[model samples]
Target: MENRDTETYPLLTPLNHRQQNQTTTVVFNAESNDISPITGAGEFAREFLVESKKLWYLAGPAMFTSIAQYSLGAVTQVFAGHVGTLQLAAVTVENSVIAGFCLGITVGMGSALETLCGQAFGAGKLDMLGIYMQRSWLILNATALILSLLYIFADPLMKLIGQTKAISEAAGVFALWMIPQLFAYAMNYPIQKFLQSQSKIMAMAWIAGVALVGHTVFSWLLMLHLGWGLAGAAVVLNCSWWFIVVAQVVYVLSGSCGEAWTGFSFKAFQDLWGFVRLSLASAVMMCLEVWYFMALILFAGYLENAEVSVDALSICTNILGWTIMVSFGINAAVSVRVSNELGASHPRAAKFSLVVAVITSFAIGILLSLVLIIFRHQYPMLFSNDPEVRKVVIELTPMLALCIVINNIQPVLSGVAIGAGWQAAVAYVNVACYYLFGIPLGLFFGYALDFGVLGIWSGMLAGTVLQTLVLFIMVYRTDWNNEASLADERIKKWGGA
Candidate 1:
């Protein structure tokens, strides 16, 4: 593991006057004699199996961590459901519409770390990870401040957006109480990517596990036993997330990542605008995808029997979110592997890794989809016992099952884009597919055709299908050689090696 690669550490360009004008780029061709490129069917199968192990090693824990963290919100929603139907609807709107917006922006913004830290770590420029992470922290904290303003005026904003007055007032209270969580997200996300890039991820999974357990107990005690209701749920969530942040900080400071973390540096404050540009690309890309579903919830708020409709849709979305964690986990793993391999200039390896990750995740998604289909009626009871909510959920279960399979494919391709540093391109595709076409079509179906909530969700699914197809084609046509070369150029330009 001691990478003594000259191309990865030393300034690879020649310093001699005679060769000063000539570049000294070292190409890590997969065809090099030292390592054979996977060619034959048997060899490719063996390579696929080997890479699957690596991919899953990263994905299994990553998925668990994602679920644990996301479950905090779901737990609060569940508790709210048990309390009363109104409380459940209130929490769903606030979480899906309000917090979901923040989630898209912050989580997406922090993903810039996946690109920077992943590539830097792959290049053996380990010292740069901390600086990249800190720079992300600064940019995202500023963004979070701007988003907090929305939370402050959430009620008016919702009413302006055409939500019911009663729903707006209740959701506003939940949103305001959830403000502290924004700052936690700002710090926690970059930390997650930074640790993940270096293959130091179990700490994240463990911390999340603890936080989820705490969220459940605290939500019950404070929200139910103490009868603090939504406020208690929000406060407990805030504390739980911060606990992960504090734990991760301690892990780094404890010298677990001797290669990556070196305390804090002023370098983090330098070249911020460069980081901002990439962060914004990721932010826009994520916001577009995440808000697509939240839009569904928003449109549902306008339907007849709005409360019942919103409640069912929210529960279904939670189910999707839970299972989607597996794909998200694969997304993270493939991002790291591709970025790392590309950074190391191994084109064939990176391509092979992507293939393995995609197939493996797709298989898992299919299995999960089957489970949802089989248990459609039984599963809704976990969130709410109301007969009407359950009935609406029954109607949507088929869509969720189908969407789960699509969800697995889309995120994996997005992961490939992230690893390849194509956030800006992906962002453009997202806007065109999800917004320019998807939303308008969804509106026509929902209102014009009077298909209601199911119509809106179906339209959103179409957008996802289009987005996934485009990304698949893009990935299929990618020249792995060019990607490796570009990764080298980007690392050098960033002064990594």
Candidate 2:
């Protein structure tokens, strides 16, 4: 009875109210409340079912859009592969470093805009969303500019990553030619987040799909008939990004975006510094997760008998990357949903949003694992004719299957942390689990124990398991009320209601 009483009322409530009166109040409150207090915060909990369903309805199309964007580069790489083995290898090297690394960094930095804009939109401060969108453009572009200069020195970085002279020269040629797309991302990602936060993800998704189809056609034409090789393929991909950007910009100016897009302004430059600091932390958390594999892949190159191993691993990684985009799509929805609910002072809805996201992600993971198992033998043959690479890939099939499961839980929770403004804590956890524990363990397993690629992969599995457990605990223990308070602060900071 005491435990029940404690659960029903906070410590101060018991001291102030008579037993009968407290009981009456509790009954009255339960009847009047509309939301699920256990799952969501304030009024959002009252409408948890409705809000969560709305987000789900929106997520399906958005996720598909995300899939299309992710596969565009893959399609380009495939086209390049047809040109020659050198072209195929060059496309892979350039993308993993330039398109994948630098572009991923820009995309990750867009999370801050998602958080801020979601909060503003939820609080009936729709105009502020536009302001934030403009401000984010100023902030993210500056970072893009700095990184572009770094891309100019692509050869040295490729060399540092253990690329052979031939691969380095080929990768450098493609990478330097790809710098403009970096700016395109700086523009596209911020706009993408701004629209998403306003529940307009579908627009960006549709446009991106159209752009992707066009991109593929162009890439094939340039690489094949035009005979431009890897550089031509890179140029086609860059044009596709611009197409997406222009389409989105046109939408923003067309009154279709309403107050979700404020006109471009110099004031955005004023807020640039603070926005960059916040965005940088979010970017680091995302970068740490993405680059972990790239590190492992590069390390494989250093192994004495690494050629077949690297190719097989690349095939597996590409498949995993393609599927992971779905999780990322869901994650974006989760961040937007949770942030919106919290900003509106609805804790219960925030909780419900997270629950739905995690459950959906897990289900997808299980399904993907099954798919990986079913196609284990057939999938490798799609990429190459090398019997040696196929053999290595067959051996790692089960590990990739397991990786799908661990990844589903981890990335979605990272989304929750982003929504709650817990980037700093999450970043610390990633560093500890991925760097401090994972990398060291994998290196030791691969070299010291002589387990080869499998050993390195097992270390990654251990790290992911540790990281997932920590995220689960962190999310479970979150105080919905405190999260509500943080939302209030974000609203004030962003000039929202």
Candidate 3:
């Protein structure tokens, strides 16, 4: 092993040496030299242990933060359910359809930061993290302005899609109240990816924890106690998300991020066109995935028993959302690891990290799936008390459990693609598998075959399974060494290295 000069390559502490101008070479042989079986096995164990520790170090906190933040809406929905099934369905449509559309775009656009910041941090180009974050914020906020129109017109749109008048009108009112959350999404995602790149997730977790607590208190006071109803829920939800945004902003400005927060600059504006293009690709990729499921809710609204179908589907999706958060944590962790290692010219390390993360996340998915199956009958009570809704949820439990397992593995692969800056390619894959193939199959089963909600979900799950397999193959065939060189080039092109 070569000795590294800490001053020259401060972030590559674990790597043996730094690559200069994409020309310097470092050898990393994967094959074991030891002839003794015992010695090789011992070395492999140590390596696995070390990688697992590094993965969980980031994943544990990231998962907690994701769950805490996601719970804001979940908690609101729970409160709405207790208010009435009508209130619950209204909130569900607004959330799953209206807000969900904007979330897909904003979070997707902001994910461009994950690629930029993760690689920049790995390459020891800390200053680029702040600039990339700013660039993402600009694009996402502008996009939010356009998406606001959706919230404004959610009522008519819901009705146009065959939703009941009562549900549409109520959901529209809730949608209007939740517009502030759109902008909050714009700011929050970039800040998250920015901090995530540098492994500054503990602060994010803390902030989210505080926000969830504050949100619950205010939700109780305004919604239940003060009789604010949906209005109260919306108000508290908006405040809680913005609170997170403001808190993260304050943290960044306080100089806690060192070189990564050298204040704002004009550089954020320098590469607007280029940024928009990547942001758009990312937006499309994520929008396809997020909207794919949002379609389930939309389709459910057209069912005979619209309210019951929507309510029950919403509950299943909510449970899926919670489980997805855990997978997303692993997704974020693996993305950071891959990009950082690639940026630091450690191809072998990046590949190892992906393997470990996939194994860990898949195991978690299996465990959660089993738990949901074991307690399937009881879990829907948390979201609804209506017998019809509960019965429908029970009927859907098997499909939901299968979704949990597939979705868990899917996000991890998506993370790998994101880390490798393969958003453009993945966007096309999502289109083919989700829209062209999955949605049509679902429509056929759900309507043509009269399988109902179960049929629709089964079709969507098939798409997810196919998409997951495609991503798995893409990851399997990736040439890590070539990817490392590409990361170096991307750093130089964008980070001015």
Candidate 4:
């Protein structure tokens, strides 16, 4: 359907320009013959559902890319499991400590790439999109070098985490080798964002799937057959990621990126400081969100019955992480779609896209909750078998399920904020909700109330719920028409729009 068609559908409630200045308010129609605000949410929700379906239509391929990216870890873990519990434990611990903390943040930095490309594509400045991609590559490459240094220091870091000498030794070896992939991880995200911003996500998905398969083959040959052990696994993982990056670059060079990719341009390096500042801000915000859980898991160790509780929480957190990655894919697509439409000066379309992304994410959240509810008893068996661990997993399943629903809205809204270029405000919201309130509450509940893993999770959920509410309010009060103009201004400043 056309965006003009969306304007024909009235908003939940009309807003006066005066009301728009406030952060939060409910506008009323005194002269209306027979309309209400509650009716507005329903009407807007209906329009939103339609728009969301359209966004998902575009998002499906992107989601495939996201799921593949996340599934690599799970596949790696499963393959390692065939080797032994120790190998499985080694891979899981290393990935959580290194990959989760490091790689996840790197990929997130790519969100800036997605935002730039999306807005440029919307403004019909296809050439600038290509330039932005190069800038992102430069930024990520530098960041990767720094992260590699950090990875080298992981052995001592793990030891500090109180892991045994043996676990730290094994984890350290894995982390050391994983450092090189910082280059791969860094390059891959910008490329992925580049493709997504152009709305050519299907190409990336196919490439990622092929890379994952190659990773599996290499893992089997190197780890199982050659007895190369953890080092072999690390090498396979790194190579596989590079393979994906190369494949994506090949597609771009072959002109699969459409006109938005105007070949590599060095001019992207001109605004180095500006790009780095924005990219760094974007990276820090995403890293905070990703590490929030890891911090809780570490904190869990400080609580009563430390070892089992931490392990159990780790398993649950891993499961949640995998699911969140899938949503992150959709969320990336949402940012691209919304930003593109807004940049094109199609406020109604951008508004419609926002509505759609939220509803689709919300529905998926509900379905995810149901899946968790159904699997509450059985899901943990896939990872470990200690009766005690299984019981803990079952106990925390409900909170995990609820978290899924909240995340559906939260991350997508964050994406919307990215598309709208409202990162500063959203970052502040994250600090207040996650750090100020959530972490402190989690400590009190987990240690003081003796609520175990669930208590820690509850604290996290409290943060998410609060964050989601604030994000929705932010999105709701967004002056989409004005942001569309600002997007144009941003492009004009770059000599594009």
Please provide, for model 1 over 23-102, each residue's C-alpha lDDT reduced to its tens digit, 9 standing for 90 to 100. 43445554531125656897777666667777877888999998999999999999999888888988999889888999
Q: Estimate each model's TM-score.
A: 0.93, 0.88, 0.93, 0.86
Q: Kindly list the per-residue Cα lDDT of model 3 for residues 366-480, writing each as its tens digit.
A: 9999999999988998888899999999999989998999999999999988888899999999999999989999999999999999989999889999999999999899888
Question: Compared to the true structure, candidate 4 yields what TM-score?
Answer: 0.86
Better of 1 and 2 by TM-score: 1
Predicted candidate 2 versus true structure: per-residue lDDT over 1-497, tens digit per residue: 01222222111111113223333111112112213445336444434445446557557767877788878777876676567656666777677766667776887787778777776665555666677777777767888888887578888887886777777788788888888888998898888888887777778878988988888788878888899888688788888888898999999898887655557765565655566766887788878887787777777766765555666677777777777888887888888877766665557657877887887889999999999899888987777667777898899999999988888778788888888878768889999999999999999999899998889989977998999899999989998767776775755554333
- Runs in model 2 with CA error above 4 Å? 1-34, 38-52, 494-497
Model 4 poorest 10 in a row by lDDT: 26-35
Per-residue CA lDDT of model 4 for 1-497, tens digit only, reads 22323433221122222235642222222222111222466676665565555576557877777778776777777566556655665676677767777765686677777667777766556677778778888878877887776578777887797765665676777788887677888788888777777667778878878877787788878888998878788888877777888888888899866666777676887876766666766777777787777677667656666556755776777777767766776688678877776665556667667667777778888998898898788778776656776788788888888888888778888888788777667778888999999988987887788886777779878988898899899888877667766776655443342
What's the CA error at residue 293 for candidate 2, in Å? Answer: 2.2
Candidate 3 lDDT: 0.86
What's the ranking of the predictions by lDDT, best on top?
A: 3, 1, 2, 4
Where in model 3 is the C-alpha error above 4 Å?
1-42, 492-497
Off by over 4 Å in 1: 1-28, 32-35, 492-497
